[model samples]
Target: MLITKNIKMADVIHMNYFTLSVLNRFGIELGFGDKTVAEVCKIENVDVDFFLEIVNAFVDKDYFPKKQLQTFSVKLITDYLRKTHYDYHQIKVPEIESLIEEMVKACYSEKENLVLLKKFFNDYKQELLNHTNREETVVFPYTIAIEDAFNSKTLDNSVFDLMETYSIAIFQNEHENIEEKLFDLKNIIIKYLPQPKNSENCHKLLYALFSLEQDIIDHSRIEDKVLVPKIREMEKVITKRFGEKK
Candidate 1:
């Protein structure tokens, strides 16, 4: 007789607003980890085979499968950013620049207003620089390492332990800080940065800020809701493996 230990099911928790929104946008159904194949089949109104297939698809894409309703992976943080934040900035930054230029043209007729717009752009430029630098230098690289470890099939307990504090926990706090800063910019754009009602240039600037804010919000949601939880779950895997070894 051959014997193999059974892997315990992961726990699935309730879906958050951000996760639901992302699922809707992607036309994907949410998978619950905590439930059994039969249970998820009942909840999702699908058969066991179909539910199992969907879960497999998520796993194929390096997404954690919710077993027992608790599914997570550290790499999910990087994956979410690659799909959402990186993609957003790749498109939004150019759009933002165009909008800023339009505002400059509208303010060209007023020298004083033109000067103010220049300063405003400078401020926003600096903010973008700081944000991108942190992601590139610290956040993205760590995530890439996690993903690489996973793909190479060398992923093990140590990586997960390191990530528990560095990538998962620290990054969660970082997302909160980033969200607050983005919120600050939104308030400034809406209430203080623009006199759009009085000037065409100001109007263009405010619109650009509004669009940028939306993009930032989407970016934040992916990191906070999807990525953080994934990392936490990976920690669980590490614990499980350790227990099994012992």
Candidate 2:
């Protein structure tokens, strides 16, 4: 079901608990006693439109309103992306690592298997960290700069200089398939690894991996489908305007 502003906030949580993370990213928490999404967002000083769009997108896999999302300012999109990164780095990654560690300690027979699993996950973690680092430090800031330059009447040489060397297309091309390795990691747990004596940790690890995989997929979808296209269009405009002078 497509969540609307008129839907009860608590009801939305009942529908998809995963949205709790989405709500938290927006600085919203539980305790809104039957208030609608709109009512709660208004009280919380959140962008109701953006909230609705993001929540709806997350709730319904088929309902990515890319055009509507693209209408939002780059700052808003980048802010959400940064928050998702925070969730991954500060919460999801460590939780998964801990689960893996517990699983490794849970069994003795599969020590070698567990070690190999650890190595695979460590490599995946490093790649994910590096990927997000590039986006946060380089790609996002560059897009924001393009946004700034595109909106401004005064053309600057710096934006053009940056443009000469980089564009959203370049970033899009370089964007690694970080999720592929993650899928492999999940397969290693599901198909290859022997179950530990305390199988709970292994189960938890698989669940965590699946959750993280979906979260990253959704996050990347926003970037690939919405932000990348938006930035590319902006880049075209800025380059055309600035390229005329130089």
Candidate 3:
């Protein structure tokens, strides 16, 4: 739906179309990568002159440091996860839980419906909680170790290889599992929280589900597109160093 035709850089200074799209979708966009203006222009398919103009506008007026941007593949994933998904979980979990309890209270008179919804909520909570826990306990630690190895020039026996062979498989499998559960839970919410012709609580629950759905989709997109590639790149660096050392 975002057309790329005839939009001048001067018209939308300080934000690219990509940033604008993400901002409109998510309510805010983070900073750009450390890539040069030329590299950004190539990726966005904008003219160099226009891209530079936009960058200069952002730098002059917006005060964003292009040098400190997250340009590298690894840094992008780390930064995106920290800023977006991590923040989403921190805010959404308690908010959604409170609403879920309200839903339980409102639907208590409907014993069967309340019980069903409670069960679904329990499963949803567990799935997301486990996913976050794994990232915190295992994946992130391994990623940090890989980065340390990369930085220290000690690539042999790196965690990067282990993550590539095992951690990634475990994470991807868990993602698929969680995706299935989320799809099931989405249908349950739609069926149970359908827009009431006369009920406000029903409307509230529906909106909550919609927002949570969007956040989950965004979280998964960042993981699949950004995180996995970064892990693989770390693996490549480790393997290359090991070979050179041999």
Candidate 4:
């Protein structure tokens, strides 16, 4: 699909399911009164170029531009990510968990199996929480430090020491593991679990699972395609600057 600034926000979302989450990052609400992307962004005071780059990235997985990333700020990316974490932990995850409980109570005959399913979900939730916490505490601060050091034109050799110990590579490696558990959770619901009596509840759970899964896939793409490359380039610059001093 052609993604031009003239395209309506609602039309773009209809064209691609992923666009909603991307626009949500900029706090651009839907029902845009049929306003084009450019119009909505202008009203919302969002950066048009950055918004277009992000929207196009989701629409076309291979469309990431390193130069465009240079124009972008790490803080902007992280703030979006942090809000995504809030959506998962504080909102989406709990909504799913509550739905699962309702399904369990509604299907008293299958309480035993439903209880096990709830346990599995709780486990997944815990793992997700742990992963986001690590990003917020460890990974994000290090990224910000790199950005600050680069901006200040101060070569802090100490930051390199931190990089050596806990780098982006380490975080990237851990990302797949977090995603795998979510996959397992989805599969268990689709294949293994018996259909609850209240089919509506089961459908609700499945819908939530599907939506969350897509959101996470898009989230991971941003990290891998956008954030990782940006930080890696920054790392190269910092390493070269420090190497010249020796």
Candidate 5:
């Protein structure tokens, strides 16, 4: 069911607890006693429609409204994406690391493989972090500038110059196939590893890996499908005017 503003804030949590991260990222704190989703969003000063779209997409895998998402300001979408990066770094990544550490400890035989497994995960983690860093430092800011300059009555030559050198297409192409690396890690644990001494920890470790993998997939879809195209359109408009100016 698509979440709407009139839905009670607590009921939205009941709809899908995964939205806890979504809510947290929006800077919506708890203790919004009896407030509807719209009321809480208003108090927190969040865009209610954007919040609903994000939450609905989170709850239902098939519910991403790409056309609608593109309608939002770059700052809104990028701000949410930045918060997601923080969630991955400060929370999800560390949680996965801890699970791996536990699995390594719980492996009775072929412990050496788990050590190697740790290395594999760390390499993937580092690659993902580097990708996130690039978006934070480079892609997001450039896109925001495009949006800003596109909307302004007078254009900024600096924005146009920067656009000439770097395009959103570069960011789109740079999206690495990290999912395969993550799938390999899962296969190693499921197929290759000996029965761990603590089977529960092994199960927990696998579950964590799966969860992070899914989250990354969803996150990438938003960037590749929505954000990049929006920026590309803005680039086209700017490029046309730039050609006229020249």
Candidate 6:
């Protein structure tokens, strides 16, 4: 869908539920009194183009902002990504873990199996936490450094060396592994886990898993399609600038 300035936020959320998360990243609360996208963004002091690009990308998987990368701040992308990490680690994952514990207690027949399932989830959670921490501690700061150096016209040998040593490609590869583990977790629950006596609990677990899977997919897409590519472009620019010096 063409997300022009006139599109209503309510209408956007109505069309695609995932856009709610996107809007939340921008700190956009609902109940905007029938405001257009541009109008709401104006009130929120958000960059209209960046907002459109992100929301559009969420709505359409293939939508990537190649031209917009030139002007967009890597910090903006990283900050949003960091917020998503916090959401997953601090809120969503803990909620699911608590639900699993509740389900285990509520359904005592398959205690052994439930315990194993909980272990699986805990393992996955740890892996995810580590992954996000690496990005926050290492990759994101490096990307920001590149952007800063680029803007300041400080393209030197050290920057080139940093880019060459550690690139976004590594993080992209790690993302695949993270996604595969999540896929396995979902399949294990769907295929092997016995149904809990409390149907409501089972349903809630499935719903949370489904929601988490979709969120992970969307999150990875933002990193793979938007963040990585923009960083790669920055890499190219820096590489060429350094090459000229050599």
Q: Which of candidates 1 and 4 is the stronger one according to lDDT?
A: 4
lDDT of 2 at 198: 86
Off by over 4 Å in 5: 31-33
**Tens-digit per-residue lDDT, 148-245, candidate 1:** 55445444666666566576577666554444544665566566653544465556555656555655654655455555565556555655655666
Residue-wise lDDT of candidate 5 within 1-246, one digit each (tens)? Answer: 978889999998887676788888999998898999999999999999999877777777788655788899999999998998898889888988998898887676888878888899899889989989999999899989999989987868999779778999887787777678888888988998776677887887787787777777767877877798899998899888877887
Local accuracy of candidate 3 as per-residue lDDT tens digits, 123-155: 777777777777777776676677677677555
The better candidate by lDDT, 3 or 6, is: 6
Per-residue lDDT tens digits for candidate 6, residues 1-246, read 868889887898888886787788788888898999999999998888888887777777677645664467899888878988887887778888989999889876878988998999999998888888888999899989888877776656777778878887777776655767767877887787777778787677777877677777767877777788888887788778878888
- Which residue pairs show backbone clashes in model 4? none
State the lDDT of candidate 4 residue by residue for 1-246, as single tens digits.
Answer: 658889888888889875676777688887788899899999999988878877777677677544675568999888878988887887679889999989878886868999998998898888888888988999889888888877777778788888788777877887765667667777887888888777898888887887777777767878887788888888888888889978
The clash number for model 4 is: 0
RMSD values for the candidates in order, in angstroms, are 11.8, 1.3, 9.3, 2.1, 1.8, 2.1
Q: Sort the candidates on TM-score, descending order.
A: 2, 5, 4, 6, 3, 1
Q: TM-scores of the models, in the given order?
A: 0.52, 0.95, 0.62, 0.90, 0.92, 0.89
Q: Which window of ten consecutive residues has the lowest lDDT sum in model 3? A: 1-10
Clashes of 2: 0
Q: On lDDT, who's better, 2 or 5?
A: 2
lDDT of each: 0.50, 0.88, 0.54, 0.81, 0.85, 0.80
Better of 2 and 3 by lDDT: 2
Off by more than 4 A, model 2: 243-246
For this target, which candidate reaches the highest lDDT against the unseen true structure? 2
Ranking of all candidate structures by their lDDT, best first? 2, 5, 4, 6, 3, 1
